[model samples]
Target: MKKLMLGNEAIARGAYEAGVRVATAYPGTPSTEITEFAAQYDEIYAEWSPNEKVALEVAIGASFAGARAMVAMKHVGLNVAADPLFTVSYTGVNAGLVIVVADDPGMHSSQNEQDSRYYARAAQVPMLEPSDSQEALDFVKLAFDLSEEYDTPVLIRLTTRVAHSQSIVALGQRADVPLKEYRKLPEKNVMMPAMARKRHGEVERRMKALAQAANDLWINRIEMGDTSIGIIASGIAYQYAKEALPNASFLKLGMVNPLPRKLVESFARKVEKLYVIEELEPVLEEQIKSWGIAAIGKEIFPVQGELSANMIAERIAGKALDVRPAQDLPPRPPVMCPGCPHRGIYYVMQKLRLHATGDIGCYTLGALPPLKAIDTCVCMGASVGMAHGMEKARGRDFSSKLVAVIGDSTFIHSGITGLIDVVYNQGASTVVILDNSTTGMTGHQDHPGTGRTIKGDLVPPLNLINLIKAIGIRHVRVVDPFELEEVEKVLKEETQREEPSVVIAQRPCALLSKESKIPVSISEDACRLCGVCLRLGCPAIEKKPGGMYINQTLCNGCGLCVKVCKFGALRRAGE
Candidate 1:
């Protein structure tokens, strides 16, 4: 049956049908849904690992046990898992292993637009790039076959457009593939210096075999057309190229890393003008050019952001096609949700006029207008380390006044090391961990601190307060972020302390709360039209001609506005 499925979901379906037994990944955009969807299959044991490295290691172990396994993560998450990834390539898997790395070319929900294709080349792994959801599902199954055939792990590279967008995907029944028996082989499984040297040679030999396999792979096909222009493209860029120059001779590549040199040279001879149209870095273009073949790329295409059919059509046609005109989307700036727990903490930080080093999560939205609380946001788990370094350079008093804000999920990802750095280095900077239970920024995926699995299985949640105390932070305190007074008091006292301090602003996410209960509203009679409550800047609260009105539909009843209202206009239901 054909059904509309997201690229990520299609990958999950692909893995399930391919008889995958285990799936693991950390929650990151463009890649989070793959694990979430995999969890729905009873045959697959799906999980949200604490970090990307752990996720990859878990998948690696599963593959070593002779079961088909997969690991998925965003482009940056690849960096965290690179250590295990590079080694796993040396120690080929017993069962088929596939790693999905979703790249965000436009920096959408990401810190940088670093190309992940380089990772495939660096790791010396075969990579498959799918242009749409159907291909996403098909390529994953093919990746597993190729992995087992070549005795190597495979990498499936995806981008934001291909991972998040929806397309019709055909469904298939799951194959009843059983786990093979485990056998300990030191020469094959162990990565000792002597063993690794032999494996490296095997890896090089596998690359040659992979390149030969790519030469006649059905995924890499040539569409015959006008001999004057031949365009080479991969992934979503292939979709754009087809729409742009429909009649041009085409070489659409599926396995991008181990590029088919013989096929590319053969196609180059057939066409008069050879142009490679791709998004971000010219991975295929550079390789094709290196083969002593003249190709036009990058110079006629953009090196940043995403590519669209219109962009390709305009470039190839030398004029704008009769495509839909660009629509002016209203600037819907992201704001803190109504009764958001982080609002009170950010409000206090803004009131005290302190600079905050922020980490990735919903709290990063605090750097936007109205709150304007955060100063620097580098990446996941970087805030604590950056804050510690800044404090060391700026003096204790100045550093104490500064704050580092991180989320519950991020702390588990890599923030623990930074927190230990603060304790060992004796930095007086205060770190505020906003524990909202779930990984809010990435669609409420379960984390180690969430007490649940990707499939909603009950698990023990991590206690942030106890964890901080165990980290040797004597000045550890937990406060309700809705209580502004307590938040301010905690921030002020912690900043004054000479020792390292930790303040956990604990609360459920506003969106999650609303999904379980009827939203609360403002009581106009008790409201004195005071603007103090407005300081929270909730989109649910608005000023009317008569009094301040709260949109019941938007309020989550976290009661952040109630605490801010001096006149007690906001109250609980039936109060």
Candidate 2:
């Protein structure tokens, strides 16, 4: 049966049909839905592991037990899982194993656009790139087969466009494949120096066999057309190229790594002008050039961000195809939500003239217009480390003017290590963790601090206070961020300390406040015309001709405006 499916959903369906027995992943955008969807199938055991490293390890363990297993994560998450990933390549697998790395080329919900195809090459594993939802489903099933056939984990790479886009996919019946018997062979399972040396040779042999398989597989095929130009593209880029130049001969590669060199050479010979269309890094282009093939790639296409049919058509215009008229598009910049709790925190920081070092989260919106309080944002867990480094370089008094702001989920993700660095190094930077009780930046997925699992099972939440104290921090305070005076006082005191400190601005996300019964309203009496409350930047607070008004529908009753109002014009409905 054909049905409309999201690329992520198609991956789940593919795993089910491929007789997958186990699936694991950490919650990350463009990839989170894969495991979430997989959990719905009764035939598969699916879970959200603590982190990418743990998720991959869990999947690897399942594979060792002789069951088909898969792990999914966003591109940056692969960096965390890289340790196990590289070694697993040498050990191979008892049953089929697949690693799905969904890449964000345009940094859609990511910090960097590092290519995942490079990981496949570095790990000596086969990589598959699918163009659409249907191809996504097909490639995943094929990936499992290829994995077991080669006795190596296959990498299924998906970009933002392919992971999130919707397309029609033909469903298939689930095959009942039994687990292979596990054997206790230390020489094969254990990675000692001697064993690893032998395994390395095995990996080389397996790669050669896989490359030969790639040459004959229908996954990488040639489309005969006008011989004047042959376009070599992979994944969604192939879809874009097909739309951009319908008449061009094509070499669409599904196996990105260990590319079918023989097939590529043959395709290159057929067309006079060869062009490689891909996003971000020229992985295919560089490899083709290495094979002594003259091809045009980044010289004609951009080397950064995503590519669309419109972009390709425009870039190759006059040279290869006619230019299409530019279509009018609406402007939609990402912003903090209407009643975001981070808004008040950033507003207070701005008022106090504090230079803030920000971490990755919804609070990163503070770097945008209206507030603009955050000075520097590097990556996940960088806030505390960045602040410490700055303090050591510039001295205490200079650093005292800065505060490091990170989210609760991000703090657990990688901030704990940086926090430890601050305490051990004797740096006097104050770190404020915005505890919104959820991973608000990525669709409210639960994290280590949330006290809930991906499947909504209750788990003991990591206590940030105890963690801070254990890190040797003497001063640690938790304050409701809605109280402006309390927050300002805590900030002032923490920054004055000679030792590292932590201030958790504890409050549910404004979006989640109603579920927690946080207060919301504005009083018409005790009115003053002052607009200080409006400066908090909560969309709930608006300015009318008479005075500031609160939209009850939008307000989470977090009382951030009430704290900002000196005239007591903002108050709870009953108060």
Candidate 3:
């Protein structure tokens, strides 16, 4: 049966058909839907692990127990799972193991555009790239087979366009493959120095065998066309190149790593001009050039952002396509939602002139104009560490003016270790956990603290206050972020402490919680146009020509603006 499916959804379907019994991932865009879709299948046990590292480990454990397992995450998440990723190559697997990594070339929803293909090479594992949803399904099943055949973990790489784009995929029947028997092989599974040395040699031999067989692999095939030019591309890049140069001879790569060196050389010899088309990094181009093949790549094409059909046509074909230019539109920067609970916390922090080291989440938007509260945003869980570092550098008096802002999900991901570091080192740091009741930025996936499983089954929620207290932080305060006065008081009190403390801004996400209060209004008769309410940066609060007014359509009636207004100008309707 053929059905329209996203690349991520297709991956899940592929895993199910490939006899994969376990799927795990931490919620991240361009890849989160893979595990979510997998969870819908009764045959597959799926979970949302606390972080990428834990997610990969869970999949590894499942694979060790003789179950076909898969783990998915965005490109950056790979860095967090790198420790196990490298070692897994040496230890191999008892059952098939697959890792799905989605790359965001244009930084559409990511911090960086680091390519995952490099990870495959660094780990000495096979990597597959798919052009569309159909190919995504086929490649994943192929990945599982290749993993078991070679006794090595396999990686499937996807880009933002391919992962999000929809296409027709032909469904297949699930293979009821029996689980392999698990053996207690310490020499094989354990990574002690002596055992690792033996396994490292085995990893090298397996890679050599894979490389030798690459040319015969069905996934790396050539399409004959005009011999004047040939383009070697993979994943979405192949799609773009195919659209731009339909008449050119093409070498479309499904297996990107273990790069079919002989096949590439043969393709290079067939055409007078050869171009390597890829996004972000020159992984393929650098390797082809290393093999003494003369290829045109990053010299003519850019190494930053995404490549397009227009760009390929203009650069390689020397003719610009008749594509219409985008119209000049007003710049719409991302902002906090009208009734976002995190907004009140940021506003209070800004009012107190506190420096906030932010982590990855919707709250990172606090660094933008008006609130301008966050001082630095590096990555997930970096906020706590950076905040502690700043305090130690400048001393306890300086810590009174600084705070680390992280979401509840993020705090659980990697921030807990940083918090522990502060207590162990005898440093004073104020950590603020924005408990928004869901992973807001990543489409509200449940975390451990959310008291639900990936399948939405009820589970015991991890209490944040108890966890913080157990971590040696004595002063832990929970405040409703909508109560601006209370949030401000707690923040001030926590930051003033000479020891490590935590202040949790507890509230459900505006989308998750229905608003009961009436939309706020501007009392123009009692109003002074002081622009204080505007400082809250709520989209609901707007400045009109005559006076500042509330945009009722945009307002959630949380009354954050009303609390900020000093002149009794902004008030909830009928209040």
| Each prediction's whole-model lDDT (CA) | 0.90, 0.87, 0.93
- Estimate, for each residue in 1-575, the C-alpha lDDT of model 3 and write its tens digit: 99999999999999999999999999888898999999999999999999999999999999999999999999999999999999999999989999999999989888888889999999999999999999999999999999999999999999999999999999999999789999999888999999999999999999999998889899999998999999999999999999999999999999999999999999999999999999989999999999999999999999899999989999998888577868998678888898999998998999999998999999998999899999998888999999999998998888899999999999999999999999999989999999999999989999999999998899999998898899899999889988988888888888999999998889999988866858898879888888888888888887788888788888889988888778887788778
Worst ten in a row by lDDT for model 1: 513-522
Which lDDT tens digits does candidate 1 get at residues 164-271?
Answer: 999999999998878978999888789999999999999999999889879899999999999898999999998988887889999999999899999999999999
- Indicate which candidate wins on lDDT: 3
Give the winner by TM-score: 2 or 3: 3
Candidate 2: lDDT of 200? Answer: 96
| TM-score of candidate 3 relative to the true fold | 0.98
Could you give the candidate ranking by TM-score, starting with the highest? Answer: 3, 1, 2
Rank list by lDDT: 3, 1, 2
User: Which window of ten consecutive residues has the lowest lDDT sum in model 2?
Assistant: 514-523
TM-score of candidate 1 against the unseen true structure: 0.94
In the range 320-355, model 2's lDDT, one tens digit per residue, is 445576688755578777667777678778888899
True-vs-predicted CA distance for residue 93, candidate 1, Å: 1.0
Give me the displacement of residue 182 in model 2, in angstroms. Answer: 2.8
